[model samples]
Target: MSTPSHAAATAPRRRNETVIVFALSLAAMVVSMMQTLPVPILGLIRTDLGTSTAGVSWVTTATLLSAAVFTPLLGRFGDQHGKKPTLVAVLGVMVAGSVIAALATSLPLLILGRVLQGAATAIFPLALSVLREEVRPQKLPGAMALVSGTLAFGSGLALVATGLLTSGSDADYRDAFWMATGFAVLALLAVALLVPAPRHKTGGRTDFLGALTLGTALLLLLLPISQGHEWGWASPRTLGGFAGAAVMTAVWVLVERKVDEPLVDMRMFVHRPVLMANLAGILVGFGMFANFLGVSYLVQMPEALTGYGFDASILRASVQFLLPGAIISLLASPLGGRLVSRRGPRAALGLAAVLGAVGFAWLALDHRHSASVIGAGLVVGAAVSFGYAAMPAVIMASVPHHQSGIANGINSISRSTGSAIGSAVVTTILASRTLDHLPPGVPPLPAESGFTLTFGIGAAAFALVAVISRFGLRGGHTTVAAAEPAAADHSGRPTDKAVRTDTADAAV
Candidate 1:
């Protein structure tokens, strides 16, 4: 069969576009659920597999690392080929992985399954790219917000499902994987039936070398972080891994500048808004995960073991935090869209950054007291949701449509890396400090202290993001207003009146 021509392939139809958005949103929700499903079942997985804590931990780490390595590569592929096929392929991989995990007899096999499962993470960026092309300019912001919010909702639901499904039995972890498998199947079917074939295709060589360099660098960095304590942090292996990661990252930067089709367009970093958004994404990601991790420990800590002592089971604990965070994310996402529409992406982003910083600070300060801790978490969750949802809007508004996928993939990688670093840093601190203080049979206190310290660090990081968002993003408004009209014209919606009004106002 002959390849479809670019214009004929991408020509937007109103009805098909809406269906595509819905399909993509559904896919995003399915993919995001993978991130949180293992949380409630971590202890059970360890016990059943007869795995060391470090070995079992790889189940989650492997998935994040795989997603970090694959997301941009898949996004670039979608840009060159088409989104529908790429998304379907990823979903299929996730289903296969879920099935493998459900049937696994060993921790190694389960880790392999998790790696395969992580491929679905790319579906989120691919969906965003598809929506950027299919949706109208006016509806784009809201659609993007809805899509992003689905990620939070899915994650929360997955946690709840894990808790409910795994409550009384050690075998229940398998049920969680089955649930994921079912979601994947549903997403794949929806995509096949609803998402129309592409009308346009872009031709570009896959940046295989760039992908290798990035993948290698990420592996080097993440391996040590995920396994350093198990391997002995002071050991030669750990030091070597960190050294290799740094060198590889430097080499990748050099190689990226020379390549015709770099996996990530490094030049995009020069754009003030893009740079600021990415930086903010990193900080927001760090803070978000740190908070989640800390709260997980807090909720799971037995009443005899901790302050604000409650005897809630894992299921109840997961549900309590999950519901509030999900609700806040759901509410904030649409509000971010409205804010972007009224003021600009910069304003919305700034507001999110400030809110995140404040919320995290509140959580840190109120560590020992009050039910307001949950409210603080909700605020932080909402702020992160708003920031993340607004970022795609800014990137899409700033860049060309064809490059949206790669742009978003790079953004995704930043978030992933941030999370990896946060997990490593937080866990390391907790482990190191607690090593000395465990009273004979008593559980650890350093873990709890580390949780507090990590949140404090996260709060500081987000505060910095707030500063950058306020200053770094201001330049984008003028640039966007200037570029948006031309982009609209190319999309066959001339912004003549808006341009004229903007120009007149500027002159005055």
Candidate 2:
């Protein structure tokens, strides 16, 4: 059924497919690392940049805002234009951002660099879109699970790497950016060489007005959530930002309803399964971040005085408390993929909630010792892996294959939003409660009760996600539904030559 030349061409493509998955998975891990890489060294960055604490906070805030805005837009663009080019472009920009941050001598320069790096948030959904086109449906679940699992791996790796790199107070910290640069360079090269061009393009026009309004709305909403602690929760700026976001969102909705080709299709967005999955993303994200920030801070509490913590430095905290959980999450991903394949995402989500609740409850009752904290984290880490793996599976199964980019991008935003909220909540609770008996000028640490309360809240969040997943996701293999007939002639579609080759392989 195949000529010698055709067989040769098909053989190379089949070989390249495995390479493509490996490259994208590594890229996903690296980009996730970039998201949390700056948190541990914030004090050093503030001092080095010679900026006030509030000013230096922008280093993280800038990336969050940029990610929130660009992720979905770029995803939609990739669907309409070309995914491989878009992926390469996004990785290239991340590389450039890493360089900018590495050389940055001022706060604005560093913030600018982080903003550019934020563009890579779009990569996750675009990677998913690519996988949809290149990998077969039966293999899709496993490949996606690997990529999704890397997110947890990257987060943990970032903490350990940050600790190792910034061991001394005088450590340049710029070395971290250089590390990001190296990873970006590798990911960029891998994507360029191994990833085949998109197999389908939406071939539609951009909706500039919808994009502008949505961007404005997200910017306004995320600002108060990320900065509201400093601005005062009830301050005019915070409240006004929320109000403006509400107004802009209403307008954006109306505009999307009327647009010929909106930035996001409201119909796909409002589907029961899609809406439920996005909501689950927010809840699960809240629980996972609470675990990460809470444990990192908890271990750093001064054991000599706090009576509950090890009084470890950032490096020790990362090693003792964070590293184990991340490694567990990495392992849990493939297990999760098997579960998803056999049972379904709903089961996976339900298990995540049960495990998270148990982990948080364990910490809530017995967190005085470091082993207890780390032990609880190991369980919760698996929960996070399952949750992350399920979210995209739930999403991809519900939407047309072509919309995977934008749909997953929006889902990513929901998680980002939840992380912001979790950070703000934990920070406020820790700061608001303090130890009464202290030496003069000794900084306050969160009361043990505060952490207990936070963990209890995290348990509740996870439990809610379980409930949502049970009711929200549609029950069926929608894989066939995702492959629309219109995709047959798109630039990303398989040629007759390639189709015949695929058929022959299937027969064999």
Candidate 3:
């Protein structure tokens, strides 16, 4: 149906789109790897840096707090200025941070490096915006799913890689950071070379006040969530953190309502579908971290002392137990994309909920066998991929093209917050119930019942995901629709090709 010139033009465009997607996926994977890289080597880090457990905890905590502060602000910046520049700058920061982390001699320097790496969380939302600009409507869901799947895949892969690298007696934690640096360099090059400039930038003033208040609220909430195990649930510091978060959250809302160009729109934030998607993000995030921590701890328990478990070394647990699920998640992503494209994100979310519940139920009831645990983890991994695939669709469909990056950024924050809560909950639950009658001078080990209870709690979280999908997300499915005639490009000139994709309902 096309002339030779038309066909030739289309082929390269398609190739370019493919490159863009690949680059974005790499960047997204790197962001997830940053979160999990130091996890398996925290012990080594503490020993090498001569820091206490509480001091080493900052390696992870610094990244979380940094992401909470920077994701939305940078996301909005990309939306207003340009995605490509923002992405390149973020990746640059990640590379520098990785280098510093790899070379650090003290805990403070390592934490500073992690803080910069954490700012790259903005890459995910900015990547999504780039997809919206370039990919065709028919192929968009698949592209988004592939990139989203990398989050789960990268998370598990980082654990495995860290285990392998640190398996020797003389292993240095800095080796993990070197690996991160290599990946960050690759991602930076791929993105800078392949991705095109933005065509739909919406110039606006940054809302510094709203950004500050929101960042403070998240910091307060996450500080308690991450540290409650050390602080004690009833401690004044923990209680004060919760109260402070609540008050700052109220202040953030007020600031957003008053700002002319807000960091987050109050109405859109409260929209039923968006609200439900965020709720699902939290539950899914919780289940994801819970699965990782609970399974890792359970399998590594010494069988002789615990009366259960496989006594898996960190390497064996990461490679033999967790790697399969991570691979399955990557493999299932295209299917999830197809599911989202055909059945809508709501249906995909429902399927994720069912699968997650089933997977956790299997683990809770029959975790004694390796086959059962691996098979169950595979299912949960796929469920996470599906949930990740569906969330961006809901967010992209609910917000205008101009607000896509910031909106998705907010959703990403919700998931991170949930992950922090999940880690804290697991720590508290396992510590609360340990084996009785342990030998003198032997460290406490979690009872088998603790594993069961943890999995049960994970199942409940997924069940909540189902409830949200069924009751909260209502109305017809919507994908990216063509931009209205009045839509303007970065130059303030009308553009026919730009899309403003949002869900439409007579009532909603």
By TM-score, the best candidate is 3
lDDT of 2 by residue, 215-259 (tens): 899999999999999999999999999999999999999999898
The top-ranked prediction according to lDDT is 3
Query: TM-scores of the models, in the given order?
Result: 0.88, 0.92, 0.95
In candidate 1, position 58 carries an lDDT of 91
Residue-level lDDT of model 3, residues 409-491, one tens digit each, is 99999999989989999989999999997899998889999999999999999999988777777655545442322244443
Q: What is the lDDT of candidate 2?
A: 0.83
Q: Rank order by TM-score, top first?
A: 3, 2, 1
- Tell me how far the alpha carbon of residue 366 in candidate 2 is from the true structure, in angstroms, after superposition: 1.3
Q: Which ten residues in a row have the lowest lDDT in candidate 2?
A: 499-508
RMSD of 2: 5.5
- For model 1, the stretches where C-alpha displacement exceeds 4 angstroms are 1-18, 169-171, 232-234, 368-370, 435-439, 476-508
Model 3 C-alpha lDDT versus the unseen true structure? 0.89
The candidate 3 region of ten consecutive residues with least summed lDDT is 492-501
Q: Distance from true position, residue 79, model 1, in Å? A: 0.4
lDDT-superior candidate, 1 or 3 = 3
lDDT of each: 0.75, 0.83, 0.89
